[model samples]
Target: MKRLLVYLWTAPTTLVGLWLAPLALLTGGGVQRIDGVIEIHGGIVRRLLRRCTLLKGGASAMTLGHVVLGQDRTVLELTRAHERVHVRQAERWGPLFIPAYLLASLVALLRGKNAYFDNPFEREAYKRAP
Candidate 1:
């Protein structure tokens, strides 16, 4: 199952590599940098779109302070705003932030709620996705 998931997630990246090679380090298309935003389109980034059912265009990623998975191109797409929320979380909590986020997600899973939506980090991410 893990392998299957990885395959499903990685297949799109192959195409992305061909398409985004020229702009790999250029930042804008392959790795865009706006006033306060950063868009990534490359091999590593393609996985974000492949894995997430909500994304589009072969998957693109962004990192405000951390990494964001922008699977699609809607305003609600997992864009910089969403990533920025995580940036805030990391800043406020310091280094223990990721572990705490993971723990909270595990708790939510144990409780049977959809962790992606119920997890506080994800909630913040989604709420700020626009």
Candidate 2:
């Protein structure tokens, strides 16, 4: 079916996200499956979100293929709509999503724009969710 194909197409990125799941679990995080997406939060996930991102405080939530990582369950709940927009983006771009997203950020910065805020993908997500 079409859905299966989309999952297959995005599998590589999904695998990358899933690679973090064990770290989350071993460190006391939780995982859930919602609307065919895997959601993860807490433990090292929170720290990673706080320190590993380009943002000063890092991101509260991030989407990778069919997986979403959040600082916590509450933040995940709050950002679901916005992150869903990214899920659709990942579905559209498949394995190229990350590269395309990074490229968008670089382009935004080169244009003297706020890379995260001005990236077209973020703009679209904000338009739908903000």
Candidate 3:
């Protein structure tokens, strides 16, 4: 089935997502299955996310594999489509997505570009988001 293929393809990132699920749940947040991806919302995720200074430019959500961690429900709703693209990227890149994304940011920074906006993954997501 297509679903099975997607599950298998995203397994690596899903495994990492599993580790974050508990934290999300413990912080009063919850996870939901959306279009075959797991969306994590609410709780201390927002505070926890403050650690990612690279996201200083108003990024309110982040996608890890099949899992999405949002600052709040509203932010999640607004960005679901964009995050889904990231889920698909995770499916394609597996666990390598994180490092590859970071590398892309680093490359952009080296080029004196806005790291997040110039990163190819972000550029793709921005282009796809509605």
lDDT of 3 by residue, 59-108 (tens): 58888887888887888899898998898888788768888999999999
lDDT of candidate 1? Answer: 0.50
Evaluate all candidate structures by whole-model CA lDDT and list the values in order.
0.50, 0.94, 0.80
Which segments of candidate 3 are over 4 A away from where they belong?
Answer: none
lDDT of 2 by residue, 23-119 (tens): 9999999999999999999999999999988688799999999999999999999999999999999999999999999999999999999989999
lDDT at 53 for candidate 3?
49
Q: Candidate 1: where are CA atoms >4 Å away?
A: 1-29, 34-39, 52-64, 67-78, 128-130
RMSD of 2: 0.6
Best by the lDDT measure: 2
lDDT of 1 by residue, 1-130 (tens): 8645533343333233234434444433344444433444544345545674322443344332333334333422435566667655654554456557668878988999865568888787777664
What root-mean-square deviation over C-alphas does model 1 reach? 11.3
**Candidate 3 or 1, higher TM-score:** 3
Clashing residue pairs for model 2: none
lDDT at position 56, candidate 2: 82
